[model samples]
Target: MRRVERALLSVSDKTGLIDFARGLSELGVELISTGGTAKALADAGLPVKNVSDVTGFPEMLEGRVKTLHPMIHGGLLADRSKPEHMSKIAEHGILPIDIVVVNLYPFAATVAKPGVTWEEAIENIDIGGPSMVRSAAKNHAAVAVVVSPSSYDGVLNELLRNDGKLEAETLKRLAGEAFAHTAAYDATIAAYFAKKLGEETESILPAKLTLSFEKAQDLRYGENPHQKAAFYREAQGGQGVASARKLHGKELSFNNIYDLNAAYNLVQEFAGEKDPTAAIIKHTNPCGIAVSTTLADAFTKARAGDPISAFGGILATSRPIDAATAELITGKNTFFEAIIAPGYDEDAFKILTEKKQWGANLILLEAEFGAEAAGENIDIKRVSGGILVQTEDKHAVGRADLTTVTRRGPSDAEIADLLFAWKVVKHVKSNAIVIAKDRQIVGVGAGQMNRVQSVRLAVEQAGDKAKGAALASDAFFPFADGPEAAGIAGVTSIIQPGGSKKDGETTEMADNYNIAMVFTGHRHFRH
Candidate 1:
């Protein structure tokens, strides 16, 4: 292989460039660098030739026109092996630049800064850097291009492999990656311009997006063994559980991600409230949820919903994890998979982490601002092929949203419980049935194909506990049979979206059972 005769080094991020350049210089490869890079290399007590010396053009327009000269382009773009191309280059006395190292200005970083001006941001865009990189990459068969600081080690190793020469295969790969890097940089610039210009219409051509995410960890398997899976950490400034900083713990699992997302999103619903709250999540549905004056009482009430199901499940709390509530939770012998809380008391941490199982899954996070900030609407799933998206169940129905369709109005206590059940029902799967007494869930039937079947499942789950309870459905009852089934299970009040054509029949059925019914004029069908 022919040795690299000359290299152009100009970079914004000089991570491993100093060492890589030193090795190159030691191998007798001549270096042609711009102002800052030349100074850096000269500062290291190495002989350096500045681009101005080679191009013979004084740096003009504040160094913007340094490397845009014909001499520089002629050397990098020339096909040395071709007689015609070589004749032109030889006539001009332009030296062949066998390698180019350049990284563009940090435009994205500058724009992301707070209170940045358009003029200031526009000024940070680099011109000569991208041009030089593309020129070198376009002639990869004769020259090597390096655009990323992370690839410095690879480039140095490749140069060392063939005694200071880069192989053709390595050159081709580096060129491809160089183009990818430039494309991503350009896309970010375009997106910023589009947003600032307030362009509402998407361009006819698809905007190619490249998201660089580092692998967080490997799971035991994907959704299925046949399917592949890997957890990736999104870039900083992104939101939700993926971005959550795990203060302490082992690696998170596939189930942990899903449950944490559900828990975090549901807790966002209670944001800005003074009351303490706790929610238990299973299979992406809240089995039990409660709010109280104290975090301890909230967990107690929430755990009462279905203590069996709460065992080895995910727990999410809105308030800081106080010692008392942590102690109460630790006292239970059940093995919970994960617990997500805003903050943890030192004592609580010591107590919780003592258990081996809890040590692997305890996640402590700072409480994010207001639950309402989670999102306006939550997306739900029916199957792999279809989805259902609607505004999240953040609705706290006022008297205006509710209209009594039955002869008797629900008692004040029943109304409160009806609203409680309504909130729980919204988080459950479609055709969901929730039974609540006082302010706690007694039973939850979810993901059934039929309303009556859902009612029966919830009633069976509650067993004798279904008596004197209010029932909430995710959607309107298609017929009166669901209400009749609830009445047989001793339900006393019903709250539904109330848009079914059989509304009269359902209301009459409620009246016959002495059960009060109210319509909220909205449905939360979480398929």
Candidate 2:
């Protein structure tokens, strides 16, 4: 290949730009730029050539038509290895561009603004920049394409080491990075357009789907030790578990991430509530959950609901961890795989680190996520050959949304406990049952084969504590057996989504047992 001679430079992110440009200049490579980039280089006392000078055509159309001329593209796309192609470019007075350094406009950020207009979003969709990047990438056999400032140092080092020329492998790798950059850019634009169309047409979910994600970490293993796994995150991450910052402890595992996500999502239902909430999760199912006046009280009560199952489980809470809660977590043979909260006090962090045996090894994360409606939330699952996509389950019910289907109505305390149990049950697996008293989860049965079995399991777990507690089922009881089992266990108030044909039987059973039952008209199935 030919030695590196001329490199085009146009980037929105100027990070490491001047140093890279100076390195290229020291290697005797010419620098070509457009618009503000050229002005910046000249202001910095670096030699640079304007695209207008190279193309003999000034930039027009509000600076949108800068480098779309044949002079620029021909330099990037000409086949340097072919004598005929080289001759044709030379005949057209177009010098070959050995390197391309570009980064597109910030389309994603523009659309993410609170009150951005369509004209502003459209204006940020770069045209000439992508065209030049594609041209350089398509001719990677003879040209080097770079679309990120992160790649600048490596490119300059290689050029300095190889006497101003890039290796073929380096060229190929840069080509891949270039294409990925443009692809991610286009995907963001596509998403913005999809949002605009939905706003205009009163519809959501686009005809085509485009997504971009970056690897967060490589896990030791997946659900099992034999399987491999890696965690990926969105390019422009919103607040959640994946975007949470690890404040302390060991690396998270595959199962830890799943359980953390489950626990975090469950606690989000209580966001902005006056009382703090806590949920202890194992295998993506909550063993216990509770809301209380203080964060420490909530944690103690949630763990007390099922202390046996809480061993080595993941805990998620809505409020910051205080010193009192840290004391309870590290007291008396207590162990947890991870704990996530919005923040941690200095004393709490110190206490947990010094008191717990596995404190240094515990995964602690801080994330800020709250409940909001009408978000573009999507849930995806992978199958054998494809993926299943649907809207995330954000359905919520209130007291006014419920109908008392039994002869008796629930008391104020029972109503509060029932609502709390309902929120927890919505995150549980299908055929789920949750029993709670005084806003504390006493028992939970999830992923059972039948609704009756779930009820039996939850009642058994709750034992004598099931008496006078509120029971919440994710869905309506298919038969009266579920209510009969809860009734026999002394459950006083029950809440469920009532759509079954045998709803009358369930209601009759509740009435006979003097159990007040309410129907939410909504189902939450998380299978």
Candidate 3:
């Protein structure tokens, strides 16, 4: 344990400053401060010495050069255990500052306000504060640094318990927190500049990418029972699954988070439509999806598309869940791992929780829908050694982007089904095939190794429904076999990105089969 004799305190946030200084003064520790902090402590009837008195140099440059002095830094950075360091400080009449308490300017909050100027933001970037913190942290074996007011009570308790001394372990922990605080502060500044410069250059990737996450919870297990796992939320708030509120259910597992995100994203595709939309997701793939006039009708049609796969799946809806929709979801032989929606009616909420066995274990989440497109957000994927960052795939095909590739053009009804199927296929995994009639999905084949197998699986699942249904592929078919299989299944129309080398052959095959095909220059490949 190291006894604290002299302390320096400079802070932008002065919470608990007077009381803390009084506590230290009562314990025979000298209090030294600067600027407003010194004035505040003196006004509170505590004896405080200004920093200029110790350094023999007044603050200049509007208080910017106050603490950049040898007297302050040598005291904070000196090693007490080394005889040479002690002799050098003694020869210079420098007293060791056992405690350094500081908190930097609120750069993040200042820039977050509306219409903050560049000049104002640049002025708020702290220099001396981070320097003092690092000096004390680097010499943590002999100094204790406090960076947050939330830590004041703990420090005070330890000081009182140990009779004005702090253990090495406490100093080490506080040093770690101090470094993390500076890193996050610097990262916020870097990200702000990156955003401003990135817009003009049309490059979203930054030279240095610094991300920080806060632990939200420790889970029971990971994807399996043996693996340990935890959940983390980004330091910056955004609109995503992490912002959702769990109204009821068992603790969410890792797999539950994956499927919930997939279901919610799929349902959000129909956010612009007046009709209600619903999606059922299993294993990060949409098993069924539909848009209908009523919420109940949407849920029923979505479930009817693939009832077996819907079991133990996650359900997401774009509208508030009503009693009728809740009843359909909780029917006999129906079981869902979770359900997410904008809101839940009182009656519906009570029935689902009170009258069913699976409801007690089901995860219910409430999230906002249709706020805005996710095009501006960056998407990140982790690989073996590094991460791949790119913009989110929010590109949607409009009516003008579609080009007819066959002699037979899509009819008005077929065009509508093709558009709906295109939206659903974008959320599916790579090598995906989706069959839709009207505005509801009839069958979906996702995450297949080959395009032809996906088409066959979807066509086989659709059965007679494939006769006039529209098909959508996430990417261009490498060969004509996929379109040929769709033709044999009686698919009336198709939509795919036409970038393949065999595009001409695929179009010829479509003409021979009397099928209408449209090329949407953009492709969505989700893996």
What digit string (tens of lDDT, one per residue) describes model 1 on residues 404-436? 889999898889889878877877888899998
lDDT of 2 by residue, 1-527 (tens): 46899999998888888999989888889999998889888988999999999999999998989899989999998887789988998999999999989998988777767678889989999999899889999999999988888888888888888888889999999989889888988887886777668778866578897877767899999989999999998765567898799988888899989999999998999986889998899899999888999988999999988999999999999999999998888889689999999998999999877754788898899998574423466688999998787877878888899899999999999999999999999988989999999999998989998999999999999999999999999998999999999999999999999999999999999999999999999999989
Q: Tell how far residue 499 is off in model 3, in angstroms.
A: 1.6
* lDDT by residue (tens digit), candidate 3, 436-464: 99898998888899999999999999999
Per-residue error (Å), model 2, residue 183? 1.4
Q: Against the true structure, candidate 1 has what lDDT?
A: 0.80
TM-score-superior candidate, 1 or 2: 2
The deviation in Å at residue 52 for candidate 1 is 6.6
Give the 10-residue window scoring lowest on summed lDDT in candidate 3: 370-379
Backbone collision tally, model 3: 0
Model 1 earns a TM-score of: 0.78
The order by descending TM-score is 2, 3, 1
lDDT of 1 at 487: 95
